[model samples]
Target: MREVFPDAGFREPVEAAEIVEAERRLGQALPTDLRQLLLESNGVLGRTRVATVWAVDQIVEQNLRFWSDENFAQLYMPFDALMFFGDNGGGDQFAFVQKPQRPDVFVWEHESDSRR
Candidate 1:
């Protein structure tokens, strides 16, 4: 992260320590790729809502939607806002997730960035 994006913001380890512990309690692993991408590229990568590497998936059951933005957990907002979009199974791309509370966007089953 520090090496890739010099301007990327950094949360003191002490500040993020609790968040890390919480992830452990939930029995979930923060998406490593997504985290790395954000740390490497702290700023928004590409066009807005044009599909960089991910998308806000609401087509499925609302509860079933795996990716979301926790800050806007109110049920109507974008999740992949902070990360870069890659590729997805349905001809879409993937995105990196910053926090655990929000649903992170990623390439679906066999989707690839090239498809986009």
Candidate 2:
């Protein structure tokens, strides 16, 4: 992360217990890299002018919000299968599609509700 965002500022690291709690709330284990990152710093900020990596709580909140939206609910069904991690200033988000053994990351476009 630092290599990609040299000027980034981060929130204080969250406790391992907190991460574990987040995982329990989300009903899935976070990817190892992401878990480690959260342990290092709950989130990244002031990286570039366009984005912020969300903290564990924010991730859960956003996912819950999206999962409950009438329009997005069906699209994001099986909610626990997706993990949102960041947002672009423009409203788009970044996330990972959880798989049995690993997660595949993608950029989720807000306007189209599509992932790529």
Candidate 3:
């Protein structure tokens, strides 16, 4: 994170209890690197003050909506396999593949509803 944003902003570190609950609610363990990052900072702010990474609570809320919201299903492909964590500040969002459980991250462009 620091490498990407030297002047990045960070919130207070997340507690272990919080991470445990978040994982439970999400029905899956968080990505290892993301979990570690959350332990160091609940969230990260980047250029133009965009939320480069969301807080744990936000992660839960946003994912819940993406994964189960019927409206989203009608508009786009299933989100059950992606764990979103951030955005590019222009509607494009970032996520990790959850079904296959890969270490690499992916970006979902809102306009095209594409992930790559």
lDDT (0 to 1) per candidate: 0.37, 0.77, 0.93
Query: How do the candidates rank by TM-score, highest first?
Result: 3, 2, 1
Clashes of each: 20, 0, 0
Error of 1 at 88 (Å): 7.9
> What are the RMSD figures for all models against the true structure?
10.8, 2.4, 0.9
User: Model 2, range 1-116, lDDT digits (tens) per residue?
Assistant: 67887988887999999988988887778878789889998888864644377889998788777656776765554444567888877788888777545567778777676778
Kindly give the stretch of ten consecutive residues in candidate 2 with the minimal lDDT sum.
73-82
Clashing pairs in 2: none
Model 1, residue 106: distance off in Å is 7.3
Q: Write the per-residue lDDT of candidate 1 for residues 31-106, one digit (tens) a residue.
A: 6654443344322323232323232122121212334436335543354333334432344435444444456554
Candidate 3 per-residue lDDT, tens place, 1-116, comes to 67867989999999999999999999999999999999999989987889889999999999999999999999999999999999878988899999999998999988889999
The lDDT-based order of candidates, best leading, equals 3, 2, 1
Give per-residue lDDT, candidate 1, residue 16.
41
On lDDT, the stronger of 1 and 2 is 2
Cα lDDT, model 1, residue 116 = 14
Runs off by more than 4 Å, candidate 1: 1-27, 47-64, 67-106, 109-116
